[model samples]
Target: MRRMKVEQAAQVIDRPVYKAALIDFLYQLADDELFLGHRDSEWLGLAPDIEEDVAFSSIAQDEVGHATLFYHLLSELGEGKADDLAYSRPAAVRRNARLVERANGDWAYTIVRHLVYDIFEDVRLEALASSSYAPLAHGAVKIRREERYHLLHMETWFTRLGQAGGEAKARVERAVAAVWDDLGDLFSLGVHEAHIVAEGILPVARDELVQRWEARMKPLFEAAQLAWPGAPHPAKEDGRLGQHSADLDALLETMGEVYRIDPHARW
Candidate 1:
């Protein structure tokens, strides 16, 4: 079946369902990156090594940059100004998965969590790269290019830490379990999934994305000499529907404080 193509913001404006789905979908992408970037940034001064500190800082910048890209798309669709969209939304309105909002626990936890997320992102971008929505497809191509490097970096850490023996291996295994337990509805397409798929804004459904993620992770688990956790359970709270936790509220307060303080400031 051929999906309808939406080439411009003008095109989206005329289609109510597609427009609404796109807006919801963009929020999911933007909010996930915004909070995940903040989490990654917290590692800036805290990573065990100076190299990792610099690396995480760069990754944090990239994630936030990616979020702004999505926010810009939402702004084009009249959601609001990009900065306003990024900084002003309350936690109850956010659409990020729970995984992105969790605190960074240990280096082991961070590495496992990052690798799992990067794989999911890679699978998602691969699907989005072919989206019938032209603007989104173009952006996915560029963003996926950068994300692949991130995946590779996390994979390196995952394997090295796992193979280092004793405490490193134990911690890696423990972190993997913790991350696995937290993986709930991480790839959900939200309430607008059917509309998004019908318009070809996102090519795959949530289930396929999760399946791809699991397939990608299996070998990484084997290479790392760790047991693969089975499929994740559906979360009780659906973040896609704007349900989040206490952590998200605190993170948002900090992320938007500067903007809240000086709404008129250029930056």
Candidate 2:
């Protein structure tokens, strides 16, 4: 597909159905990063090791930055200011996958979670890097560079923890079990999945992305000596459709607290 500027794409997708699909797609991308970044930042002063603390902090910042970029793109489409779009939305309206919205658990949980999420993000961004929406494609190229490091960092920890052959391995296994069920919806394209594909906003099919994600993780799981948690069950409520857990509600309360106190304050 030939790349087109946002304005050019807008002209082509003048119909409401196409426009709405594009917006929904962008929201899913932006919300995932924003929520996960917030979750990751929870480890700022709490990571097990100082180096990991610093590394995770940096990764968190990058995820937030990526969210900001996507939000800005949405703003260009007349959504609202990026900050308002990000902070003012209720949890019921957020489109991040359940995997990202769930609270960070133990260090092993965090490692496994990051491993799973980073692989998905890597695949998603690779697909987006060639998106017909030119600006998003450009942004994807930049974000994927930083994301590569995140994948490496998680993989290193994943392998080490798996090979440690003690409590660490057991903990990671437990974490995997806890999150496995919710993994099914991670690649869901929501209600307008077909329209989004037809409009060229998502260059790759959702199923293909899932396949790539699994392929990428298979070797990592093996090297880590971890069993692949087979076939995830459908989540009772998926975030793509704006259904979320109480954990997301709590997270939004904290995340938007400062903004709500004074939405106009410059900071």
Candidate 3:
């Protein structure tokens, strides 16, 4: 049976398991955006070319803005202020995939990983657009508009690197191999995944999400004439479970440095 829409946060108040599942899913969504946005910002003034530097900076801003939107949704559910939620969480409670926490390697790695993750986000957002939770579905519809441009930007780079061949092709392929390990966790929805799906918060299961992402990548692969890397293998540590790399710790320290000094200070 199709689940009825949850029109508001107050509708979820009496359902503990369902509400918890919803909260966990929101954390994953918010954290991934925050981490990846931070990574993109690191390329500010350091991108391979001036135009690319500006473009990446803009994308970073978009991603962080998206994170703020998700955190705001959490705040509506009584999760606390959006600023504190993004900057104050310990690594153990974060639900983002470890892939986002990784350091941006060379340009090729950044291109490959960002494109790969964007493809996954495309799949995830499509699912969310129809989420039984009405607010989330509406929000996803808004996010997808901006994300389409992001996907286009990354796909352009991914194909450019692949078709360039010679040194460029070699580097992109190597980055693909390196990034595959982290890709495994990209579809995971944490410990509450079953409940989340059961509650119709995401509607799509993990395996289906991965399948859709892989299918979507085919055209890009063909355009670049790149070989399939097969399915991504899971990382040994599960970021969905709050397990994360030291890289995330360093990221939090830096990202929250100012906020920590004065949690109550207006931004």
Candidate 4:
């Protein structure tokens, strides 16, 4: 029985090819959310303002929840339990782009990542809402529902900080420029683009997704009075592609310390 009601509908591709694509796509989704969430969690009591702190905490939790959903999907594919897959992956094997692995840098940078990543994610999920694969299609629909809150939160801060002027404006501007270069790969298909599309899992092409993201972000940039910085850098066909940063390695070690000790032991 179909678990989700098919909505609008998308073109069907190939299945076997899509399975691997699905895995790759989900890995990017889960790993990015997990790493970003971990970094954000460190700021729990460190935020500058009480209200802002609470808001950041909520954003962190949402990222973790997003990761959990993707990990569960991976588990259904025989990868392992969601927790195991999430906490046990080797750093070098992680597929999250370098952008997410970098530290929050500053309140400005953190917000920058939140806005850029969240907006791009919104576009991607909206596109995926029509995924041909039943599971992904359904999951995308559910995720999109919660994502509205994220966008709203980020947009509020983005406008406040961007227009606040002086220190705040300078900080946000610097933050936006800092990560603009590395932000490109966040939309990359790596080597799975054709596979995913060929399998009819996702409706649109990866480039198409990038274009849509750029279009969606253009108005926000204008509203903030931020200038377009041209196209972001593409992944260098390693690490994110198959190559990863040292940060990921250390993250794995820390996250896995307890789990690896007694895989069968209940927490």
Candidate 5:
């Protein structure tokens, strides 16, 4: 299929089914970045070292920027202003994977989580870079460029933590176990999987993308001498389906607190 620019896609999306599917796909992309970026921002002045704090701050900013880009695309589709879509939505309406919604635990947990999330994001964005939806494809290209740095940074930390042995290795191992169960939702497309794929918004199938994500991560896990955590179980509440954990509720409450206070007031 020929790539359709945002305007062209919007015209075709006059079909209700296509419009709903496109919106669902975009929300999944945008919410994941927004939630994870917010989680990363929690580390602002609290990262392990001064240098790492600076690096992580930059990464958080990038993730939020990526989220903003996706949200703007959603706004063009008439979902409302980007900030409103991001900050005003309730947890039940969010589309981010459960993995990102979990609270950041220790530095070990944070590092492992970042590594896992970035791997999945890397694959997802690669697929989007060729999306039949032109705006998403263009945005993916730019986001993926920045994501490369995130991947490198996380991988380095993952390896360092894994090889640190003793307490560090043990901590990372525990984090892996804690996070492994929720990973399945990263590939989930909810009930709209068929429509999203059928609409050709995402050129790759969800299963194929998941496979590619695992393939890329296996070697890295081995190199780090960490046992692959095996397959992830289905999420208890699928985030793609708008079913989320209480963690998300608390997160949204905090994230939107100031915005909700006076949404109309300029920041």
Candidate 6:
């Protein structure tokens, strides 16, 4: 694909019922992908193996693409330019959960994050694929088509690292345990959530969505001998509700540096 494709931006929904909620939903979607893409971009030249490096780069590119799509939607709503919204927001103002911004750590942690985040993203995207808002549903469909490869690549690593003896297994297990506490934050809907649900843009209940995610991921974790995380940590008191870790601060500095230099300059 080209560096970026201006696939038609989502059509404007003029009805008040859908308007604010959809915009908020779009921002959440855009923010999550933008931060995750930034995290992935950091790994461009740092992956363990060359073939793995190449495969990961493709996934990173897709994340960037997904961010661009939602950015365009936000731009159309007059919420500043897409790049500014992505790269100029204050760290606390960023809507992404801390999980997406956490450093990939060692190769094992990177793979662990990859497996966890990608699986969750796949579940969310599948839900979005059926969005009540036609444009979003369409965009989700297109994006999910590319997401299959991303999920597969990560799944393969999860299996390899899980079944591998000694060091690799220990690494993955530790990383998984570390991230389990923050997983629910990924599914959080913020203050604008009532409007989002009432507006029918994302029709599924949050718990149901999480359950679906669990169902989808359970088998993969079982096969790898990795335990699925127990208990749900609500985002209300969690780092996802604009309450983030220091890791987010570091990420925003790097992610926003280029855009903040001259927000008007065409890159």
Cα-based lDDT for every prediction: 0.88, 0.87, 0.92, 0.76, 0.87, 0.75
The digit string of per-residue lDDT tens for model 1 on 79-118 reads 8899888888788888998888888889999899889888
| Highest lDDT against the true fold, candidate | 3
TM-score of each: 0.97, 0.95, 0.98, 0.88, 0.96, 0.90
On lDDT, who's better, 5 or 6? Answer: 5
- What TM-score does structure 1 among the candidates reach? 0.97
Q: Which RMSD values do the candidates have, in order? A: 1.1, 1.7, 1.0, 4.1, 1.6, 5.2
Q: Compare candidates 2 and 6 on lDDT and give the better one.
A: 2
lDDT of 5: 0.87
Q: List model 6 lDDT by residue over 1-267, tens digit each.
A: 111111333444445545666776787788778777777778777888787677777777789889999888777777877777877777676677667878878777877777777777778778777676666778888988888888888888888889885999898888887777667678887766775665556767678777887787789878888777775577544444577788888888877777777889976
Q: Write the per-residue lDDT of candidate 2 for residues 1-267, one digit (tens) a residue.
A: 553444444564567876788889999999999988999999999999898899889899999999999999888788999999999999877888988988998999888888898999999999887777778888999999989889888999999999998999999999999778678778888888997876778888987888898899889989999888875676677789988888999999999999999998887
Candidate 3: the clashing residue pairs are none
Instruction: Report clash pairs, candidate 1.
Output: none
Worst 10 residues of 5 by lDDT: 1-10
Tally clashes: model 3.
0
lDDT for each residue of candidate 3 in 34-135, tens digit (9 for 90 to 100): 999999999998999999999999999999999999999999999999998999999999999999999998999999889988999989999999898899
Worst 10 residues of 3 by lDDT: 229-238
Number of clashes recorded per candidate: 0, 0, 0, 5, 0, 0
- Candidate 5 TM-score versus the reference: 0.96
Query: Which residue runs of candidate 3 sit more than 4 Å off their true CA positions?
Result: none
Model 6 spans > 4 angstroms off: 1-17
Q: Could you tell me the C-alpha RMSD of candidate 5 in Å?
A: 1.6
Which candidate has the highest TM-score of all?
Answer: 3
